[model samples]
Target: MLFRQLEYLVALARERHFARAAQACRVSQPALSEALRKLEDELGVLLVRRGRAYEGLTPEGERIVRWAQRILADRDALRDEVDALRTGLSGRLRIGSVPTASGAVPLLTGPFCTAHPLAAVELSTDLRADELLRQVRDFEINAGLSYLPEQGTEGVRTVPLYEERYVLLTGPADGLAGQPHATWTEASRLPLCLLHPGMQGRRVLDGVFAGLGLAPAPRVETDSVGSLFAHVRTGHWASVVPYAWLHVFGVPPGMRAVPLVEPVHSTPIGLVTAAREPGSVMARALREVARRTDLAGVLGALPKA
Candidate 1:
């Protein structure tokens, strides 16, 4: 019934352990347990499955917890709205982005911060596309930067930000360096260093090669861009990265970044927010920033190899 009780319940559902959930809620174990029991009594349903340890939520508990999430999100939205009316926009804006889109997030965050100096932004750039969307839908994050889902974007609003283009980065002495452009076929022949298979960017690059009846044999594979860049710095490794990355991290010394052409490819990356009635004010603010940002133009203006 109380918002505090709902908060505890949602934390419990997320943590799946009583003590950890209580820790997240900043309350004692007994306090969290008593609150949930009271919530169950008021709702007339057994909300948790208990057996000396935190087992899991019951069937009805599962459904109720979803509603609890909604209720809490709506409550936060109301508070943010009222706060904005009084003291301007002020709150933490949480955004989750797929690792490949890491460079592009600054386009939105930079403007958002300047526009609303009172607001705080928390960015998580290590999430995969699937995990990013899930957090957006759950209200665990205010918004997400990722590719549009193929099947359906049922529970979120999509705001297309930019078209993500690929570019081949190589050292000066590398095989394809100084070239105006490199095809997927040509790039695959080098001692490549690419993102690991689990990343969306890797999957996309693999699909492109698979269509050509070729599979890239990477000499080095990594999940971190820093590591990939380090390998490319050796002049013996080449990697394909998104063009937007050049906007944030310019071509390092002794390196070149050429557009990947010969049947050019681009992925549509966008901002996703929960499709709820009273959405988070922070999300709405970010959407406004996205509309005003000339992301495509900014990324396209980067110097070409």
Candidate 2:
């Protein structure tokens, strides 16, 4: 019945442990349980499945939790609105980002901070594109920085930020190093190190290769951007990565970043937020900042690898 009860229930659903949920809510385990039980009684439904340990929520609880997430999000937005009117916008702006776009996050965050000096930022950069969009839609994050999904933007709104062109990163001694540009076919033949196939960047690259009827067999497969760079740094392997990354992590010494030609591919990265009516104020502010951000001038102006 009360916002605090909904807060406790939402926290419990997120933590899935009575003790941890209580810890997050800054309350005792008994207090949180009693509050949720009262919430269930008031709503005339059983919400949680009880056990000696915390069990999963009931089906109704799942539905109620979704409602709770929305209610809490709206309540927070109201508070932010009032605060903005009274003084200025202030709160933690949560942002989720795909790893490939991690380098560009600071470019957006820095200006957002400057625009709203009282506001704070929290970033989780490990989410993949699909997961990032899911979280943004679920109210789990205020905004997302990622490659725009080809589908599933029905409930999302995005502001285009920048475009990333693919480049071949290789040592001086590689066969393609001296060329003005390399093709997907040429890059596929090298002793290559690549991101894990599940990553968005990898999947994009895979799709391009698949279209060309060439399947690259990598010498090393990793989930880490740093690891891929490290492997290529050893001079034994080559990699194809987004041109945007060169701004943050320069062409690792002894490497040349030749443009990938023969049907040059580019991925559009953007600011993704939920398409729901009356969205988060922080998210809107971020979009405004992204609109003004010369991210293109920052990364796009770089010598095309």
Candidate 3:
């Protein structure tokens, strides 16, 4: 019946614990429970499967949760619109990005902030491509920086940004050193540190290796790019990573990067948002920023590794 009640219910469903949910809502446990009970009474349906402990929501509650998400999103969109009109656009722009594209997001957000100084931005890089698409569609994130899904995705809009190419990172004494470029086959034979297979970058690299009929067994696998760099700094390990990352992270003191060849493959990365009409003002602003971003110029400014 009320926005606060809906917020309480949504928070409870997400946390799945009465005490924790209450903590999240910044209210007492008893107050949150009473609010949910009141919401159920007003709606004339049993929403939660109540017990001594926290139980899951009922089927109808699940439906209501979906509606609550949309309603809350619309409410925020309205607020953003009014705020933009009153002064200037000012709200948090939540962005989900895949690990590989994480470095390049600043290229878009930098100019965006200069244009709309009042706006706030939050970027999360741990999400995979599929998670980014799902979150964008579910209104969990305003937009995402990810590769276009191979089979294509539904209920989403995409703004093409740039192609993601890869390079091999190694120390001067490494096996592949002194080469202008290294092939997948050539790189696979070395002691490599790579992202986990669950990550989009790793999957793409796996696909390339599979296509080449090669299997690369990495000496070290991790989720952090920083870790990969750290290991490669030992002068005994190497990694194959995005070309943009080489420019973004800057080749470490002892490390050098060489382009990947023997068939250079590039994947397209872009800004993805929900396809729903009347998108949030922040989402629209990001799309406009993406349109005006001179990706080539930005890339050219970085020292080539």
Models, CA RMSD each: 1.5, 1.9, 1.8
CA shift of 215, model 2, Å = 1.7
What candidate 2 gets wrong by more than 4 Å, as runs, is none
Number of the predicted model whose TM-score against the real structure is largest: 1
Q: Rate the local accuracy (lDDT) of all candidates.
A: 0.89, 0.89, 0.87
Model 1, 103-170: lDDT tens digits are 88988898999999999999899998888888888889999999877766889999888888888999
TM-score, every prediction: 0.95, 0.93, 0.94
CA deviation > 4 Å runs, candidate 1: none
Rank by TM-score, descending?
A: 1, 3, 2
Where does candidate 1 clash, by residue pair? none
Candidate 3, superposed: residue stretches over 4 Å from native: 300-302
lDDT of 3 by residue, 1-305 (tens): 49999898888887899999999999999999999999999999999998889889999999998788778878888999999999999989999999888888999899899999999999998888888887887788899999988666787899988888888888898767788778889998889999998988899999999999999899889998778889989888989988777667787688888888978998999899888779788999999999999775565342554
Task: State in Å the error of residue 264, model 3.
Answer: 0.8
